[model samples]
Target: MEEVAVVTLEPWHPWPLVFPAIVLATGAVMTFTGHLRERRWVRDIGMVLVVGGGLAGLALLGLLSGSWDQAQRAEALVGLGYEQPTFSGGDGIVGGAPGVIDFHAQRDGELVVGRLVPLGDAQWQVVEGFRDSQPKDSGT
Candidate 1:
């Protein structure tokens, strides 16, 4: 009898983007209302809210930017024929079929490189390498 297992992966949540925007907007409104009412305490409270919201927003923005960068890198890799990309525990896997080829590339102390993985069985081998070539001319 063949055994089958179903694995489900959850989609990425976008609450980080929404939470900060909501907080910032609310804080701005509170600050504006407090200023209009000419209440020092209320104005201070609004300012505090604004600061908190701004910090939260900044944190979320950084996270979003990092995510976007990763996505762009992944897209580029895929475009370059890297298949079945997987990153786990500081290691990455790409392609699969026979056996797995694991390798890492890095430059300097701060410049990190993406890892390339090859897949195939023991008898078969897959390689991950890149070549520089000009784009083909596609007439508009």
Candidate 2:
């Protein structure tokens, strides 16, 4: 039997993208607290922060998405030791065109949609990755 080498990836770094979400979430918490306390100033400030943070954070997500994709590709290539390899990805949309895909390859690559299943007590596996994550005719 051929042995398949396991490529281990370090812990994922999500801090860059999490900070904005935290800010937006903070706005919500403050808003709720202010409303409960009957503090108009806090409520108003919270509203402003929520709206502003939501918009800004969403925009940042778009950028971060690209960055995340690049990083994933880089790491995978390093692990596989390939000069150019492609993985599934989607359009700017989270997981590609909403329910149409689970993930995308690049800005214009094929979209992949699938659900994860529990392989064991502490193990999970992606159905799509095991089945149809390969490039067909895109020549990626």
Worst 10 residues of 2 by lDDT: 98-107
Candidate 2 structure quality by residue, lDDT tens digits, 1-140: 12223333233355675676777788898899999999988888888888888888778777776667456534543443334344444323343222211322321244333322323332323334334455569756
Error of 2 at 86 (Å): 15
Which candidate number maximizes TM-score?
Answer: 1
Q: Which regions of candidate 2 fall more than 4 Å away from where they truly are?
A: 1-14, 68-140
Cα displacement (angstroms), candidate 2, residue 108, comes to: 28
Query: Cα RMSD for candidate 2?
Result: 9.2
TM-score of each: 0.41, 0.40
